[model samples]
Target: MSISRRNFAIGLSALTLTACNSTLGTTSNSGAPKPKGLPADLRPHLNRDYAAWVASFRNRALSQGITESTLNAAFRDTGYLPGVIKRDRNQTEFTRTLEDYLSIAASDERISKGRAAFTRHRSTLEKLEQSYGVDAEIICAIWGLESYYGDRKGDIPVISATSTLAFDGRRGSFYEKQLIAALKILQNGDITPSRMTGSWAGAMGHTQFIPTSYQSFAVDYTGDGRRDIWSDDPSDALASTAAYLKRSGWTRGTKWGRELAAGETASRVLQPQAGGPRFAVTGNFNAIKRYNNSDSYAIGVGHLSDRIAGAGPLRTPFPPDKYGLTKDDRIALQSRLTSNGYDTGGADGVLGPKSRAAIADYQRSLGLDPSGDPSQQLLQTLS
Candidate 1:
């Protein structure tokens, strides 16, 4: 999941801290140093360093043809965001089986909301489908998965998030490119710097386009001279997603994929979990992967779109997940965990990292392996 959806869905694993080479003392490479007298008043020094870095970056943006006005506006109050680094390093909450992922990604509630959104934007979706030759439902599914049909279009400032990641130096070069691309977007006047907000990793808009992806694929489909994906109106966002799919070799009038029953002649079958549902994916499935690059994510988009378009659930039954527990058992386990002081977030029944951490904590108390894999025996033990 390399897309914004992936960035948001997957955790950043651990917080990444770079060596700040300012006049202030460098963070210790060894154990915490003894109190080395009164710590220097390093705030001003660090502030100046950050300001200088921003100035240098602004110069680079200028060299790349971003207007001085855009750079100035985008960086007016630019400062390092430590929270962005924390979130960027956050690992996913839970490891999920395909079934578990589907339970959340293509759940009934999501599908219902998706249908409503689809109906609300039917005219616009149809026109985009006709123009781009990509299915309307797929676009809607991408929108739903990326930002919950525009209901959760993220809140982190794009400039701060990207710049902090660039400064952090963990993935410095990649994030630097994103930062530059974001400035280019500002220069293009697609959105005001004040409104250029997105996920902590800088995936922006309803469809979660990273700055570079937006540069390559975003479109001003609304003809308003601005490819405004940040607006409440999702017309441009949806249309941009359609354009991306179309350009990614989306086949006109072909299904993204079909659920393959046992013995079905499938060109390519992907069964992420043993004994779980299998799918015969098409080129369109690959096209969706170009959006997020996760097999589970691509399937979620394809299956959710199929559901929104009135297709039935997969006839093939999914086995218990890797934890050897079914979906209902997982829900019960979450409820028990929360009630037992583990606080598995909510009983939404998706086993993300939080739920697993809770489970691991409980396991540790009992001297268990702390693998955090839920089993019927663990549920009974908790009971």
Candidate 2:
């Protein structure tokens, strides 16, 4: 059997407590010992520290030419949100497999909705295509995928998330630059502070755009003089996404590849899989990849966009060797392999090559097939 088709695809609180008993204070001994507790090194960093980091960030933003009013307006009283950190660190939902991902991301319902949106906004999409040289479906698919056609723009404050990342020091420089860019967006008046809420990772707007992307690729598609991706009006966000694709070399007329009906003989040719998926890809496919570097993501977007435009499911199946297992069996087998110390990155039930290798190693240890194909029998033995 083979698989295919498509695939498709925060809270913070602060408390200040002050002991204010005049009589008790006078009665207490002057040399009362401080309470014994673990040192600051053992404790997590405090939100107050985040406030100080933000204070320093003011200077950094000014250095980047963001006005003080915008800096104060956006950054004032903002603190490190622990929920944001939790969300960013645990990005992938634990149970989401590649197949499951495609099921939701490239579902028939979404494609149908997207096609309707393309039709409803045909004039806007056509103008965008003419101006940006990017296809309407590509833009609409990205919009639908990123935020469900703008129904769910994120709610996390950009300043808070980016500031936390900047202070966390793991990728401080990268996040600090993003924080500065966010402030600049505020200074430019593209969106009000109240309306500028976004993802826990600070990607704002209908398209989940980072601050730099908003600055560089966003457009005033409605001619309202503001490149407002955060607004209820999706014209700007949709157009911005198209602009990005165009600038990234989107072919005006090329399709983003289709699933190939490769024969069994093609399975023997694994050497050519280095660049991308085995399916025949086009320029538009690579352009989508530039938005998100993952090949799986690009494939999902491309396939979903095609489907949205009335194309049906993939003409060919993704060979079993690709995942080493079908969707139904992947989760249980992946769980067994992961329990045995093979970290397949996740147990999302999609058997990518790593999961296959893990299955093979487990089988070899158990004196069974080493061909790396997962089966119910193998899963049973592992369990």
Candidate 3:
């Protein structure tokens, strides 16, 4: 089984951080409701209604064996976060092309950092792979992607962020449950609430495990009697990620997947975009997907791992997107569209919503399907 929708931090972190965003809603792709629930009209976090909800939730936490000390410590400075709600609501609705995604996910800088991390942690990482059957380079790749080799674990307070999301009533149920799991972690003394900082969506520590996922997969690799993922040491976090992949059915010593040549074929070839680069994935690729369901994310991790392990870039060129516009072509097309009274945002060479709208409007003028799909024919026609 693959990692659930809630565990896709790799995909979620790529948003542009626009102020006005739409919430992912209380339900995710699996149609499961996220955890939440406070009075309907209470929007700002840490208000009276939110406080009341927290009080009520405390009872539930106690029922789950979270201690009083843990609750107090967690809720002491915990308050509602409107900023988190903005991020939750403002997530990009569309997926990026695999090439676009990997530009950041496995960029030159990230790859370099991944190699450094691999070198620095080789001893511990090799032992982890030996114990868990998950590749050490793959672990470094995840660590690099999640926290930039532990340089950028987020600083948002986990209790406040998760509680705010829970009380906000959008993905409230999911956040609520994560908040509870967080409390359990605190109760177990694995990490203090003060140090339980992470992303707005509750993904924490160097490996960016969501709270519930942390509970399920985190281990005390340092043998310190606690699973401390928030500390400076990334051993526990990396080990936990390896453990996650191991349990998700990672195949020992197998490559995650290989990028295909122009005319190559494999039994499980996955070509996400028709003209883009293709891959012949293995069960290990599927195992990577168990960490994040998106093909781009799995491919990013797999490719980055390979790169860190001294592999080269993709062998084949990924033709143009379905748009039939290469990145440079898209920039030129956008310039043409603007001259033709169809304003795409800024000719950034990426087809975002504004670009699509412009394409759609242009298509409408041409008496076409108005599907907003760019093609060579459309580019030629515009020319």
Candidate 4:
């Protein structure tokens, strides 16, 4: 995903932040309510203005060389997904500290899953590394982060998603371009419109490539005629990611970076968190950034890659957050809260919305201010 599209997905919901894809489907365009098994926010909402916008967009798409047949097939069942617009507009600006990011990105579960995925796909990944000169673990790490190793390759139809965003007009031009690219992909017979499902932002497949990126970098590594990334097999998606990284200047043999031990020095060093561990990075680090363009994202990929390759967690501890709660303290707070009949949604140490809501409920029950901030004071109170 492009930085703008990826950032647009941030903070809308925990699912959007942590998982790029959902298996939910939208309601049909027939104006009949159907049980789609989707959350209310994710269900399609009818809008006349959206209909009008799509009508106008059809002309523009045709002018841009999208075939009429392709347009009709793509839009036959597609409708304006208000949930997509809600996700786009409701993105919070909160930036996670590197500590919080790593805690989620390289969590024990994610690391374990990455290793299993790497092993499961070892033959394919090693071949990709040989063919593309990008690290197999790096590709696997990207897969883990993008769509949870293909567990959540999303189920939202791409035409509906991209067209809805293009009509919403927040980042109209960009999404319009993406919409056109998606149409092109459809016209090229890679996949049918119904099978072309992806994230709400139209980032598709195991590695979550937006339509434009897919057009530029997606490949048919399976030797199949189609560049099918949304399939049960992840070979094409993984190969596409490797190709993207190689084209983005990944050095053939250099490591992305490593957590710097005491007395270690490098020409380039990054300390994304003030008192967190520093990393010695290489040009390959920049290459990883070209995929997502966030220091934390790149570090998360590199660190997760290292963990998948049998490396351990960072030795240095992160300083306490602004609320004076270290990661362990936060984890304990969450664990205690959950035990006390409040669901903090698992003690991952990152006090996300669910944990905060649980904390606020606990505080309110005691007639304390419902400020959701976690602190040592709160930890002690819970104790």
The candidate scoring highest on TM-score is 4
lDDT, each prediction = 0.75, 0.65, 0.77, 0.85
Q: How would you encode candidate 4's per-residue C-alpha lDDT over 40-118 as one tens digit per residue?
A: 6666667899999988988999999998899988888778787888777776777889888888888999999999999
| Deviation of model 4 at 353, angstroms | 1.0
After best superposition, candidate 3 residue 38: deviation in angstroms?
24
How high a TM-score does candidate 2 get?
0.69
Q: Give candidate 3's error at residue 140 in angstroms.
A: 1.0
| RMSD for each of the candidates | 8.1, 12.4, 7.7, 2.3
CA deviation > 4 Å runs, candidate 1: 1-46, 92-95, 336-342, 357-373, 381-383
Q: Residue by residue across 234-270, what tens digits does model 2's lDDT show?
A: 8998888998888888988787876655442332222
Ranked candidates, highest lDDT first: 4, 3, 1, 2
Better of 2 and 3 by lDDT: 3
> How close is every model to the real structure, measured as TM-score?
0.82, 0.69, 0.77, 0.94
Question: lDDT per residue, candidate 3, 29-98, as tens digits?
Answer: 2343433332222222437887889889988888988888889877775566677767677766677777
Q: List residue ranges in candidate 2 displaced over 4 A.
A: 1-46, 91-100, 263-278, 318-383
Better model by lDDT: candidate 3 vs candidate 4: 4
Task: State the displacement of the C-alpha of residue 4, model 2, in Å, after optimal TM-score superposition.
Answer: 28
